[model samples]
Target: MPDDFAPTPTTLTTADGLSLEAQWAVPLKHRAKVVVAHPHPQHGGNMHSLVVSTLFAHLIGSDCAVLRFNFRGVGRSEGEHDFGEGEQLDVRAAVDSLAQSGDAQCPLVLAGWSFGADLALTCDAPELAGWFLVAPPLRVLGDERFKAAPDPRPKWLAIPERDQFNPPDQAQVAIADWTNAEIHPISGADHFLVGRTDKLNALIDSFLSAL
Candidate 1:
């Protein structure tokens, strides 16, 4: 039930004792809980940001629980940006909190947008069911790790054809190493895919189905 969903806001604390705010939505019954990542905090990114919010709404149907949180230094999260170093830690910690609390083998999905995509590739969680990345900046990713990432966990890259930040030609080269990875191109959209909520939801639904 990863379509026709809903959202709920909640808060959780980091290992360093800082408070991080998030939108936590679940189906009527317990399902897989997704740990979502946001874009760069310095660039006005938060859980409520347009694309991230749209994704969370799509994942919280009758079979899943979606958690979209503000990374360190954004919104209610205490502390400042770690240039992706500490941010990866924050994502891992969020995953740990959920796993340690008894959510395991529930098809954990790691998803992010733009900057969030770059940072999420740096994680090393074996339990991760998939990586959902949109508008990832190749330069920001800084290496071939994303390319060489093992295929037991698949990857989904969403790129807007007209995205000023990441064009098709560039995305083609960046997505070279992903075996199961599929990059969906959208027409007439920017990096944020403005005015395309319905399309985004459909794409997210398809991803959930494959899992």
Candidate 2:
């Protein structure tokens, strides 16, 4: 991690009183805030997941306060797994926590990877200025919140070329009529974004910059 992006350890209490482990990275001056969610907790996803961590590193000096956390039942977070149900509250709680950080007036961006991406898409935080999704597995996510309406908020979807779950072709079909989502097909990237962290981070940075 870059010296400037070193995060401060923190704990967030969800609306249902679940304590979640998190890290907050804020530059000297910030113009916006981003709340990031990781992949499936049952699948070894956490705040430290490569994709999540890479995003944290990428936002180091971008004037954005970034918050990444482990969902319930993961890491030291309290409560059992609630599938994607209770996890929705977790995302909201994260947003609320960031809102209290004195940057509430700034644009708020939400981001996630795979399972986390599904949660971000289903999360109903109207305060969000944008949404960034990386390799979301449509088959596993049955939420209709995103598909039910046309959201005006900017949405960026990055589909890996060789994703294990959803590739660019499949992802395009799944989100064909999605609000204002702009899909980007990443070359040589997988669902885990292993060798494409740089590309993912760059795309995300570009998305945020345009906002």
Best candidate per TM-score, number?
Answer: 2
What's the TM-score of every candidate structure?
0.84, 0.92
Total clashing pairs in model 2: 0
Off by over 4 Å in 2: 1-5, 145-149
Q: Residue 41 of candidate 2: its Cα lDDT?
A: 87
Residue 115, candidate 1: C-alpha displacement in angstroms: 0.9
TM-score, prediction 1: 0.84
**After best superposition, candidate 2 residue 26: deviation in angstroms?**
2.3
- Candidate 2 weakest ten by summed lDDT: 140-149
lDDT of 2 by residue, 1-211 (tens): 4565568999999889899999998665677888889999888899999999988767766777899999999989899888888888898888778867845677888889888888888765777888888888865457464432267788888989899888888888877777787789899988887888889878987887889
RMSD to true structure for each model, in Å? 3.3, 2.0
Model 2 residue 40 lDDT score: 93
Q: What do the candidate models score in CA lDDT, each in turn?
A: 0.72, 0.82
Top candidate on lDDT is: 2
Clashing pairs in 2: none
Model 2 TM: 0.92
